[model samples]
Every structure is written in structure tokens, then in C-alpha cells.
Target: MSKRLIVVFFLLLLLQPYPFVWSAEQVSALSKQPIKTVVTDRFETGVVLTKKVLLPNGDLYWMKRLEFTSDHREPYTFSIPLSGSNGTFRYVERLPAGNRWATIPVDTKLPQPSGFLQTNQMSMLLNASNFYIKNVQGTFEQQPNPLPINVIRTLDGYKIHVHFPQKKNSIAEIWGLESKESLVDWSSTPDLEAIWLAIDLQEHSKWSWDGYYVRSPQTYTPYSPNMFWRLPANYAAHSFIITGGSRAADDLGWVMLDTILPNQNREGYWETLPRSEWLWKDYGIGAGFFDTRFNTDIATLLLKGYRRYGDRHFYQAAEKYSYYLLAHIDHHHYTNYGESEGWLPADYSWKQPHKKTHVSLNHHLHEMNFLYEMYLETKQEFYKEMADKLLYGVKNTKSMWIKPNHDLHYAYLPNGKMGLQDYPFLTYNDLVESQSLFVKIYGRMDPDLAELMANKKQWMDQTGVKGYRFFPL
Candidate 1:
């Protein structure tokens, strides 16, 4: 062969895609074993895996991971033993993307006795001076109290150790053990034990919504050059809109936004700014207008708030925004696509050639459903008509349903591809949302279609993605 021809051949070979290869030993082990062990210590109880199975495509995967707990009731630890003789395998910890695990010190020493006194209960005792106590234990023959002292539990019952704050002169006193049975008699106890337990847990639980820590410099932020008023105002707006007055959600959202928004506004939106030196200057202008997403969220919040509180002001605001969205629908594609047919460009930038094409079917469906509900509330013919058209367009659009495989149903790509072999990969969130939209629309229109969608949603739910927007009503 000529030297030039040989060089061209080498170039061609380099350009070709490399096929995935598996070792013969690995394949044989995977086929014969049909099981692999996975151990997870996420929950209070640890999980154990014991079996691995080979897929039809020869991909090795796990079949079942049996869970054997050390403590059956509480489940603190679990263990699993595999029987099959498989070759040496490497263990991989599946940490969430972009997050790193850090090792922290563990305190193993037992707490001191004086530190075990309950502060809140002690305060109440100090204030009252006269309180009835139930003594389940028979250890103390003579009851020491101002008025009433009742004992009900064994002396050596399971003792709970508690730590008290350090003080100059803090006194610790031991009371008779209170039996769980004594809590059944409400007349004698006045306060329900379950209610008190819940209250105690609420006071002590580590699960709290104190807000996001703003010190993390790597987080995303929406604004730059912190203006004190702007930060708090933006935080309040985001909190109220996203959380719907839930104090915890509101606080967390606010804190997270505070930390991330500054960096996000400066760095994140730099590409989308009008006077940017970036290759795509027009991209910035398009992004500035993309604030419509926030408007959409605000409209939703207003509508929900109005529904909950019957506030006419909120209703009026929602009505105005709903009309604005309805007015923007392209009437030309109404027959083919529906009210939302040609709305929302395929890409973030409006200048792109793929801009006007269909993007997220799920987002389109959600917009349709939202408009439909608004139509119902206002009895607007335009809103109603748009909702109906969008629903019809979505159902009939073959491009919207890309059958990637026999088991997989994917959203359409810009080039009408079936696989994720295109830009802007479809996610589980998109699929679930689309399914939910279909369920919502069909449930009201056709019960059979609704049922089928619901089953599909259940299957999606089993994939381990929780808090899916769609749940059976």
C-alpha cells in the first residue's frame, strides 16, 4: 500500500466509533454467577446485595439484594452472604454527582448521669412547684412530692441518657419510671403521651429547615453585588412562590437562592447578556426574556393562593397572566399542535435554527393543563379552546412519542430520533411530567386512557425517583 493511502486508512480507523468490549473471564463469571452483592448503609438499617444477573444484551446487573437486619424493630445494621464462587469484583459507592463524601469523627463515650436531666420538664417543675408524677417503678417505697406521686414501671427499665447544658448550679433529680400503660389513662395524665412524644421529637429532631448556608462559594446564585434589600426581597418572593407559605420551604429556598443567585446572575447569565464578548451575543438577550419562567411560577402561586384563600386580588393577577399566555399562542398551528403548538422555542436561544421546533412535550402538556384549569376557573372560551387543541395535538403527534426500544418510550428529539443520541437529553423528570400531563388530560376526557397512563406512572415510580408530580387522585 502507498504511504499516503496507509495514513488515510489510519485516519479513517481513528474516526470510527470504538465498540464496547468485555473480558472473557468477566463475561463467564457474570453469566455463571447471575448475582452480585451490593451493600448500602443509607437508612438506619444497612442493605445487602447477594445476586447479579446478566441482561439479554450481556450487560451484568443485580437481580436481588436480600436484607437481613441486626435489629429487626429498628434495623440499625444488615448483612448478606453470597454462595456462588465469582471472580474478584470491585465495589463501587454510588455517590450523588458533584457531591463529595467526607469522613467525620464519631464520639463513642457514654453521656454523664447529671447531664441526663430534661431541661424543659425541669423548667415546668420549677414554675409549678406542685405537679403529679407517675412512678411505674416500685423502687421508692415512700413517695417524695408536694402533693401526688404515682409509680407504675419497673425500677430497672430501659433508661434513656440525655445531656443538659452546662450551668453554674444545675440540679439533677431522679423520678420513678413512667410506664407506657399509664399513658393510656388520659384523665389521670391530662396530656396525651403520643402528642407529647411528637412535641419532644419536633424539638429534638435534626431534620430542620434553617435555610441554606450562604458561605459556600461554589453554589449557584441569581444576583451579583449583594444589595441587602434586593437579596431579602428576592428571597421572600422565591420562598412564597415555591413553598406556598410553608415556613420551612420558604426559609430553605431563600437561603439557597441567597447563596447561589449572586454567582448565577454574574457567571450564569454572562453568556446570556446582550453585550457579552461570548460567541453567542444574541443568546444573552434571549435569556433576559426567559424571565417568563418566573412569571409562570408566580402565576401558579397566585392561582393556588387564590384557591386556598379566596383572595380576589390573587385571582385577578392570575387571570391577567393567563390571558397573556393565551394571547401568545400561534393560531396557524392550532389545528396541528394546539394552543401551545408553536410556543416556547425548541432551544433556549431564539436565534438558533432549531428554535421554533417542538422541544419538551412534557412542558407543553403542563402548560396546556395549567391553561385548562385557568379556563375552568374563568370560563374563558379562548383558554378552553387552547387547552382542548393542545391536548388533541399532543395525542396525535407521532413525533412526540419516540419508541427507543420495546421497553423504553422516549420523548422526541429535534431530528425525530428515538434514542438520546441527540442534543438536550430527555430526563426521567420530563418523562414522568409528560405521563402526568397525559393522565390529567385523559382522566377528565377518557377513563381508559387515564388508567393506562396511571399504570405507566406506577412503573416509573418503581424506578426509585420519588416526589413525582403525578399521583393517583
Candidate 2:
């Protein structure tokens, strides 16, 4: 193949579902009978798993240990082998209702599988010939349960349908899954992993409410119909957009941008391409809508997209945001509740009187990093200078927020105190990455920043970013 043709072929191949096909026997072995965690009416549950592990640098192993359950007793005895133990399987969230993100132990007896899989994901081994993924959350309430799959109700002594959790990242997990319930058995998996892949790498040509267009306003979120609930802004907020640098992510972002840009209010601070857009219906819930941090992140990604796609608007968006940050380089009123500091706003948003809140270590550092990237891309010294000034805020305030064990308090509270809680050790990862970015920018790292990074990493090594869902670290 010629180079150009080879490149095309490579992308086409990449678009295919995870290339592991199970044999007739492989399918039969798992489906004919259930591979379960229950024993004589008791359960031997494992930890709930996610597509990505919070801890860095380790491999994800598959589990016979389906740990998400109410029962806390020891194994009554499991249906599958539980060997090669590494971690302990501790509970991250202990809420009575049990609505939380759970964690895996430092070491456990988990079997390494043929390819990537999560304890939460259905192995394609389950016979789901009936139901379909109705919406983003894989809700199946409206669909008919003709397959007798998940049809067992109260009279049947069933409390909740027992099945594996299926939160696939790529649509790759369900390529050949078109079986019927009669020939197959059931429909339990949500099987909704199309959030990243643009329906097999094909473009939507135009955005529509009917199709997947990179999540936003999900029917009940803010700026969505009525703010019925905030719909998890922390992880879901910038993640889709932050997934922007690569060609595939850019493809998804185009659809997402189309959804957002068309209806945005765009009447906030930063007035530059970097300015915040006011998309709320109430008119004035949050002024400026946090253009400083959120828009800065968006602008940097836009810069990346512009460079690769060579679009003028991309450059314009980032250009405005970068200038906004620079224009307010001396935001004295917005700093540490009193003293003049160059930190970016993380917890709250406003620009007129400059709404101030506790300084978020992650937000400040992230903005600093974004500024440095903007400098590198546009060859501007001012962005770097601003980033340098922002770095000083972290160093001076480190002792105030960082615990002696190196775990970070989530933010510098407005009451002139450090928060009691930490982010399960996420700040450590931020500190480590920030040092690398600065090192690349200045050809060396700051001594104070370097020391902080070292201590944070040591802390991470000792405890793999363990955090609870309801309560923070």
C-alpha cells in the first residue's frame, strides 16, 4: 500500500470494534449457565469497576469478583476462580443507599483477560438478544421484555435483576451483538458506549437532538430545560471537549460545538474569543459563567483544533480567551480573599466585581498550564509570564493546603483556611504533570514546585489516590 492509502487503511482498521471474536465454545461456556458471585443465596461480591482506573500506571484486570452489592460478608464461596491476589478490595463509598463510585484494592487475585474489559462491563458473553440502548444512560423502561430476559418481577422473588454492568467506552464492545431473546437468553447490559466513537467514525454532517452529539444539556441539566438537576458537571463538564486534540475527538467536538454554539447566550466577561458564554435561561444565575477557568480550558483545546484543522474561528476563540486572562493579569481582588495574587478562579465565576471564592489548586494549575501552552503555540511571552505568576500562588499557598502526608486539601477556602477534604489524590497527578509542562517551557523546573511534585508522587505511590464518593479524601 502507498503511504496515503496505508494511512487510510490504518484509520479504517482503528474504527473497527475491539478485534476479539469468541468461539462457539467460548460463548457457550459462559452463557449456558451463569458465571455468578452468588452462593446458596449469599453473595461474594467484588469491587465496582470503571473503564479507566483512577490510579496511574497500572494495568486493569478482569474479575470473577463482581463487587457491587449490599452484602458485606466474606465469600460464601464464588462460582469463578479468584487467584493472583494484589489488592484488598476496600469500599470507597459507605453510604447506606450505596450510590457512589467504588474502588479496587491495592492488590487482589484478578485474572488478566484476553483484552481490555471492566467488571462493570458485560463481556459480550452475556446473551442480550432483546433490549436496546434507548438513551445515553441505557434506560430500557419503555421497551418490551418479550425475551423473558429481565422480565422476572416481584411475584418471582426477584429484588433487582442480577447482571454485569456494561459501561463500554467505545461502541466496539457490541459489534456482532444482534441476537434475539428466544435463541439467546436476556437483555441486561446498557451497552451504551458511543459517547466517544462518532458512530463508527462517521460524521453526523449536521447536529440533531435525536442522535449522539457529544453530551450537553442532557434534558435535565442546567442551561438545559430547567436545571432539574446539575447532571454531574465535574467529570462530564470538560471531559468531552478536553477529549479534543486528536482527529477522532475533533470529529465528536465538531458535533458538540454545533450543539452548544448555536444556542449560546455569549454575554459574559473576557469579551475576547476566550470570553464566557451565558447560556442559562434564568438570565442571571451565574455571571460570566466561569470563563476564566472553563473557557480557558476550552480555548486551549480550540487552539489545538485550529492548528490541526486550520480554521479561523478556532484561532479566534482561543485568541479571545488568552487575551482575557492577560488583560486581568493583576486580578488583586480575586486573589486569596485579600492579598494580590495571579491565580485563576476555580470554585466560582464572575468578572464585573470579580466574584471570588476559594482558590482551586487544580483550576489554578490547569489555567497556568493552559497559558503556557498558548504561549508555546502563539509564540507569546505574556502568556508564559502570566503562567509564571500563577505558579507563585501555588508555591506560596502549598503549606496552607497540602497536608504533611502530601495529600492535598481540595481548595484554599475563602475563610482564609485550607479545606479539610482532598480529591482522592488527584492533585498529586496535577502537580507532577505541571512540573513537566513548566520544565519544557523554561528548560527547567522551579525548586519549590519540584519539591512539591516529588512529595506528592511519593504520597501517590504509598496510597493509589483512594477517595470516597459522598465524602472527599
Candidate 3:
């Protein structure tokens, strides 16, 4: 071959993807076989691999190694979502030796005493554990954090660069535990838990922490910065503490309430933000428009916090927000089309009702749930009456049903049009809670709500456990 041709061939060979596998003496806790490394597939951006290990006991376990073989011109921003059995999955990180395993027992009201190490130590595990990684191996380092790391920015933002570097053929690993036998009910929806868990991991992944929240950098892709302040995030919280709760969840939930109480405005509200609909843009009102959605959401979560921790402060804060929700309705009905009477706006102004604004489906659901809870707590028929009115609006005015997928509409606009589909699990969760409240209050399920829940469940099963959004190339 010509020398020039030989040089070109060498470049092509070097750029081509290479897969790596390593066998470790590490025994799988479950399969009890020597843990084996498995390489999966390669995408345009990076290669993906599943490093399977025996779960300490013979239970099923999957270890995933995320890394790359190409040199990026700049720091690479990486995010790959997984679709799991629309059921129960636990994301447990392997810790260093002498600090291997500890668990928060299910249903324990108090946090487990931290004798071994805090769950946060799992972060350290990413930097140090390399049993699953390929080209780049890691040494198990203990608590004081022995690895010297750097920080760099990708398209996502600046992160604690584990030096999970953008070097040729580097690897980093993160472990996740999936349980299909436990029969988690949402059998087919995307495994958002695993998706979110991947943020902290750096199987050649970047750990970006913006200045705003040291621990919480821009973890999500830009378009999907889903409702940092616009809507309720109960589902995100759900992913955090399922069944057997954790110390992290307990602490985070408590701190959230504590922070909100002091920061709430005198009118029993936080600074209002806009709504999201089409393509992650604020198609609703701009900022400073106080949406009733926020009040209802805060109130509902506070009520939950009160129930969980018996905090009077939580109840007090929730009650204030509850009052705010009822008081802020847009009585003028500018976009009034369907059962417009007693319906709320997508957002409202403190000075006057937000006329000409759109109607929100999530508002109806959240407001209904919040008001019903108020009635239960305070024994006020007024709360039930308002909640019933909102329920009536949904049942009579809106055609939220998506028969094939069983999804609900996102927003009801002035032109009698509904645009966008509700997040796969959000509305379903709302309907279930609302139905339970309806049953508790009136001793019977609301027929419409029951149907909605049933349909939502079906949709969830069909969609299964896969991340909803795909980052555009």
C-alpha cells in the first residue's frame, strides 16, 4: 500500500470503536459466579456497556459501564436513558471496602443511624470503584476522598469533572439494581429513577454542579429542565424514596419545607413562574404571573410532609397556601370555553385576575386534590364544594382522554384546542390521589376519576419504563 494510504488506514483504525471486557475475582452477590464484564452497543456520541455482576446473593443485578474511546475536541456532555421493567428498580452504588452495604429499612419513620457511611458516599464510589469500568480502571478509595479530580463544562454545564476525561478509550462505571419480581405497578413507564440516578455517575460522565446549588448543577439537558419552579415535583420525590424510605429523602423533604416556610411571601405564596407546554417553552404567561398551580402544589406537598413528620409548621404553611389557591381564581373567564365557571387560569396576577390566559389541566387535578385535603383536615364543606366544582369542570368541559395511550391533554386554550400531552405519570398520580380523596370524603369513587385512573394505568403499562424525552442531535 502507498504510504499516504497506510497513514489514512491507521487513522481509520484508531478512530474505529473498540470494546473491552475484564473478568474480576469479585463474586456476584446473587449469581455467585465470578462477576463478568459485558460490552453492549455504541452510539454516535459514546459507547454503552452493561457490566453484569452476581448480586451478592443470587438476586439479579446489572452493572453498567459508560465510557468512550474517542477524543472529544471539548469536554463531552453525556446522558443516556434506560428503559427497565415498568416495575420496581433500586439504584444502589457500590461503596468502598469496610463500607460496602447499608440500607434504609422500609416504612421506618426515623432515619437509620449512620454507623457505616452516609448514602452520599455513593458519590465517592463513582470516583473510586472500577470493577465495572473498562479502559479506565479505578482504585477503591475511602471517605476522605483520595482521588484528585477536575471540573469542566460540556453543553450541559460545568460539572465536577472526575477526569472521567474526554480522552481516547477512557471508562467510568455506575451500578443500578433492578427488581422485576417485586411487581411494581407502573410496569411499563420509563425508568426515570435510573435516568435521574445516572446524573451523578461518571462512567466517563461529567458531574456538573453550577454555582447556584453546589450539589445540583444543570443535571438535565436544556429543553428538559422540567419545572424547576413551575409545577409540583412529587413524582421526582417519588423516585427518591420508594417503599422503604431513605435518610437522604427524609432530610431533603424536611429541609425543603423548612426553606419554603421562611421564604413564602405574606400572601402565602412564592414568587410565581410561567407554565410549560409546547417544546419546553413558556407558552403560558411570562414570569411574575402567580399561577394557582404553585399554591396548590406547595399546599399538597406540605400536607404530605405534615402527615409524614407530624410537623405543625408544615400544616400551618400548607393551610396558608390552600387559602391562596381559592382566592386567586380568574373569575372573568377570558378563555372560558368548557365548563368555564369556577375554573382556574394557567396563571394569575396579584393585582387583578389573569384574564385571557389559558386553562391548565394540571391545575384542575392539583387544585382538586389540594382542596379535598383541606376539607378532610378542616371539616369544611366549602373545600369539598370548590373541589367538586373543579372536578365538574374536568368531567363536563374537557376531553382529556387519549384512548390509544390513555394520556391526558396538557392545556386547554382559548380557541377550544388542547395541546401537548401530560407527563406520562403526573396526571395519573393526581387522578389516583383525587379518587382516593373522593372515596374517603363521600364513601364512593367518583366514576369519572376511577375511569381516568384505570386508563392511566393501562397507558403506563403500555409505555413501560423508558425515559420520555430524547435529546435532539
lDDT of 3 by residue, 139-190 (tens): 1111121233333333432233322344555554433332223212223444
Q: Between prediction 2 and prediction 3, which has the larger TM-score?
A: 3
Worst 10 residues of 3 by lDDT: 207-216
Query: Taking the tens digit of each residue's C-alpha lDDT, what string does model 1 give over 1-473?
Result: 12453344345335633212335653453344222233443322324233332322233322222232323332121111211111111111224562221221112222111111111111000011111111121110111222221112223321222221222121112211111121122234434322222221111111111111111111122222220011111323343444332322222232223222232221112122221122134223332322223344445555655454333444555555554444334421223443244333122322233233334444455556667667556554455566656555555554334332212343344454433332122233433444455455445433333433444454545554444444332
**Candidate with the larger lDDT of 1 and 2:** 2
Q: Compare the candidates by TM-score and give the number of the best one.
A: 3
What tens digits encode model 2's per-residue C-alpha lDDT throughout 1-473?
12453344245335633223445564553333211122222233433321211111121212222333343332222222112222222122325874232434323222111111112212111211121222333111111222121212233122112223322211111111111111111132222122322221111111222122222334222223211111111222244455433222333343333223322224312322112233233223232244444555556656655544444455555555554455444443244322335453444444444435556677677677777887777554556666766787776666676578876667676566777565555565566657777778778767767666666666666886544111111
Q: Could you tell me the C-alpha RMSD of candidate 1 in Å?
A: 27.0
Worst 10 residues of 2 by lDDT: 170-179
All candidates' TM-scores?
0.37, 0.45, 0.48
After superposition on all C-alphas, the RMSD of every candidate to the true structure, in Å, is 27.0, 18.5, 22.5
The positional error of residue 30 in candidate 1, measured at the CA in angstroms, is 68
lDDT for each candidate structure: 0.32, 0.39, 0.46
Q: By descending lDDT, how would the candidates be arranged? A: 3, 2, 1
Candidate 2 differs from the real structure by a C-alpha RMSD in angstroms, to one decimal, of 18.5
